[model samples]
Target: MSVTAVIRKNSYFDSVSLMSISTKANGIDGVDQAFVAMATEMNKAVLENLGLLSDELKAATTSDLMIVVVPSEGADGDELVPLVEELLVRKAPAAGSAEVSHRTIASALEEDADINLAVIAVNGAFAAREARKALDAGLNVMMFSDNVAVEDEIALKNLAHDNGLLMMGPDCGTAILNGVALCFGNAVRPGTVGIVAASGTGSQEVSVQVHALGGGVSQLIGTGGRDLSAEVGGVMMIDGIRALAADPGTEVIVLVSKPPAAETEAKVLAEVANAGKPVVVYFIGGSRDAVLAAGGHFAASSADAARQAVELSSAAASAPETLDAGQVDAVLARLTPEQVNVRGLFCGGTLCDESMYALLNDGHEVFSNIQKNPAFQIGAADSSRGHTFLDFGDDEFTNGRPHPMIDPSNRLARIVEEAKDPSVAALVMDFVLGFGAHEDPAGVTLPAIREAQRIAQEDGRHLEIIAYVLGTELDTPGLDAQRKALAGAGVTVTSSSTVTGEFARAIARKGAAA
Candidate 1:
């Protein structure tokens, strides 16, 4: 086996486009594994873990792009670096498309009077400035960049509110506007249910569940994850609630997020009380009584929220599906006496939080990087003690890298790492599908999954893998195909995020007894 590393000085590419390059490089023949990313400290550590960090790359800066490829035995690794670099070359513009380029937001708006929204995905330092420009131009803004200062976020959101323009996020990842899915959002039918969420994957799971329940969404607005924090004060949340309340097409509303600050929750619930339409609320670890007193229904999970919204919207929903007991028993039957913990490697933060909450509620001690209690926090990124659920999309993992949804390299590495642990009984995860997600998430992650199972079998233990795909039949890599692929790999693919958590809990409970 041979490893090759190449670096391009001062080269830069957005996370989304770089994902494409990484995907293409891995598909090349003779390649065993590929790592293509900017040489940030975190990325260098990842490369070091993969045994691909060369001496020259160790000195590379964040502005430098690094490509590392490991070639299979007998294959020439030296010849692969140039080929990988070729993937970075931008494709030529199609005929007549060259004239459409705009130098700034003002230029674009001046040229196209119909442009009403600007999607900002620059570095966090420059994100606020661009968002401010869009707001000044009377355009609604959806900022996808993270790492912006809290003060800048508050100022931008306040300006947007004062101008009567919608400000979606400083780190917002998903939204569905006018039947069009935007930035990591799933494809779903357009109908009466409207959603306002401070969680990206949380909103996604609810919207997909609503679609599965025979109801549809009119609009799914995202108010960046920090909207409900005390500092930000739920600016976009209140604005989103008002927008959906007055929307004629919306008859039922759903609000999803982790619990907000006490004052913020009260303000949001007060708004819900006067929505003049049925509302379903699902806030992780939040107060159900507060929702009930505010005249809104409280949902126990994402699936429950969708069911309530469907019923409130008067949609002809189908009966909810039940998990197969036989399948659960079959998995638990194979676990060894020493195997007892569930290690969830998740791409979606909300999905991770939901599963952790489910395990904790069932008397299982779940340790995670997102843990609220200091007692349950994992010691390190690679550490998994008891039941550990790690959200790979957390800032520590994604600070200067692409989210795991778009690039599964980090998660793929962690899968093998976790499998080497003797106490790990089951692996729980999520495959997010839709517009900005990977083209085929299951297809890309299958090799790692197979390798993990191989390691467990060699150790004479069974590794139960449970997964939930958050998407619909309408998504690019449709739900049915992704689930089918995983099921073929002997994975237990649950019907919903809630079911996925339940399945993991069942394994954890049985493993504990073993």
Candidate 2:
């Protein structure tokens, strides 16, 4: 599809629109275009990077940098500073302002209208209704909403498709265009690993793992949570694959989703048949018998997706073995039954899921939410209940990114807060590595660790610390030093999954002693 996107720097109204199908515009007047902002200076507080004319434009020469992204005449473009109320993904096929700061959606909606949009977008559900109105105005709807229902997503996607437009999502999280993330997404890794998934956390974890394995990514696309639902038709997932196949940079594709109904799976399999690139499909809990007719590979786990992605990036028929047994041993020992109770507090959903599964397998009764008599968050007093793996990323807390890998403060705070819980004994974290990631998660985590340790010591809790890092400082040089810094501070590290499992088992065995 030929895309024409425009970014206005001077206008106070900013928006993204998609122009689909042929349209008749007698003239600028007939087009019903209007930009009416009489403000002396409008504010732009963007949550995601939707691109200002240039990077220099991203900086605010005025006011507070606390604002996400703002509009100022500064050194950007000559067009009016577009008012983006809530910066979100821009797949407009047409352009509109986002991130309006405190401006009302109605005011933000009053943007230049010469070009018709096939879809209008806001970052997530906060803008769903407003986005729909723009869609009614012939915009091809692509929204960043994460909580949209399965049926709503299907209808919107279908309506857009019927009009020859594409609808992005109800819970769609991230999208990369020309290698830059237009949402709250990490920077592109830039390799042959192209991913299309029904899960945001799963996809993010896969991408992080791929990067850790010395592989980059061609593109990563999200198909929302219910894309494969029987009601939704799974069109986005299908189209995402087609788009990846078309991108020359992508040599291999990865598809991840929870199991769909049998029929939906069949349809997805049928669609996979035509793609020329080798694919690795992971349908969580999918049967081994399920196969992709086309030359596609199926993997049993997300980590396997990481392994396959590395294999695809290298031309060698054989995969590179970057395993370091030393690091592995360190991590495994921490999880050993003799360590301490290992509790996990994570921001990312997938990390929580993986940690829960791993800890459970290690023989710990993982309490996710404290409300269900789970050990972590039910009561202010209950948080102290030790021998728990708590995921702070559940809907109750996280405001934006679920994975603490992106924003460490909130998750770290949860970790420290949990450390104060008298019943707790140990803590575990995943040091996710990649671009747009905290320079050193362990570094960021160390202060919290020390505080937790200090509090534990004061309380006579004697908390043990262990971490499961996705990357090795050894492979990344200074990164190894960073890992060592944490180790030096008393946090043991494990190099790979095998070691993490061992450490967790140790924690369980140790917890039984407590």
Candidate 3:
């Protein structure tokens, strides 16, 4: 393989644009890997890590756009440069366009005094500076940039609090304000359920499930992943809960997170206790008694949270059509004696965690790269243990690449790999749909599912593919179409990740018995 680098001086593109360009480049016929980003220090470090850095790239300024492409063997590296340039040009607007984009937050506010929120996704080193400027201009902040220091996050949140404003994230990925879906959010119908979440996909899962169950969301606030940590003190979570409580449009409040520090949890529960509105809590590893004791209801998963919130809001809940015991047994009965394990490949970290928790609670010895249970941790990320689950969106897999949400290539390859293992009884997966996600996630993954099924059949084995789509009908790449595609591929598409997990566990349990 050959690596080629191109530097465009004085060129600028936003984070979303760069990610799009990179995804486009990687899709080229002969390209093995591609990275399109500004020459910021953090991006340069990423390039170095990917072994795509060059002397010329190192000399490029932060204002320059750097494009790197690695060609597969026997592919002409030089030929791919034009393709990258063409893709960038197609993705970006003309340089001479009359519609001008603002260079600073102050200018943007000056142009539109009604602008209430600033979505910042710059390099981590400069993310805090831009966020401060936005806050100073009296704008709420939704930070989509990662790599920011914890200290900076605390300072930003404190400043936002002092000004009576909401700071969604320093690494926040999902939120819905008023009716606009911001940064990595899905399009759900607007209604009475408002959410405050420290997990991105966790909130998306809940909001989508609510929409699917004939309920809708009024607002969804993201508190980033660290907001619930001891140092950050769940500042944003408490503030979000309070804001949603005060909004007349919101009737039921839901809080979602993986697990918070003990002290932080107590403070958050205290705020939830007096929110007046009915509250549902889904702290992944949290205690149910704690929520009940705090005058709030506890939900076991995102799906459960949505059901409880919809019920509290007086919306009719669409009963989930899960696999019954006999159906599960019938499916498991078809599995050969050698097929005794379930493999889950997930794009959302929280979904992976929930699946692991469900399987473990079902008395299955689940192993995962993101497992909180050390005893069940995978020996290596690339190696699958008994009933293994892998989070493809983990930093290790996305160090210099677009997230799996943007590109399902890695996950697709792993699905095929798992299918080759005769011991694998079931393959469970999740497809997340929303803004900033792949336009045709189901279409992109359907080919792999077909190939996996083909391989399993060739080996005289049956591979049951179970999938759950986290999205609403309103999201682009409509949820109904995605589900239909998966089902057409001979895969059992469930209504939610929670239901998918339960079904997979049942199949695995019966497989073990067989």
The C-alpha lDDT values of all candidates are: 0.88, 0.55, 0.88
**How would you encode candidate 3's per-residue C-alpha lDDT over 1-514 as one tens digit per residue?**
4788889999877676777778888889999888888898767988887677899999999889898889988888789889889977643567887665788888888888998899999877789999999999999999998889999999999999999999988779999989899978999888999999999999999998888889989999999999999999999999999999999999999999987899999999999878999999999989999999999999988888999999999678787555567767767878899898999999998988888788888787888888777887663345786799998887777765678888878798889989999999999999999999999988999999999999999999989998888888888989899999988888888878788878887876776676
TM values, all candidates: 0.90, 0.62, 0.94
lDDT agreement of model 3 with the native:
0.88
Highest-scoring model, TM-score: 3
lDDT of 2 by residue, 1-514 (tens): 1111233343332212210000111012222221211111121222222232233333433222211222232423112112221232334443566633334434444654543432234333335665556566666444654555565677666666566554667655555544655443454356778888876667766765676677777788777767887888688888888888888988888887756667777777777678887878887656556664444677756777778767866633334333455654554443333344567665455555555555555556666652233333352224534455555545445332223444465566667786776555567666655443455667767888888889877865456676765543323324467668778988866554334445555556556764
Clashes counted in candidate 1 amount to 0
Q: CA lDDT of 97 in candidate 3?
A: 73
What is the C-alpha local distance difference test score of candidate 2? 0.55
Clashes of each: 0, 71, 0
In Å, residue 99's CA in model 3 sits off its true spot by 5.7
- Residues 234-347 of candidate 1 have per-residue lDDT tens digits of 999999999999999999999999878889998899998788999999999889899999999999998899999998896898876667889888887887888889999999
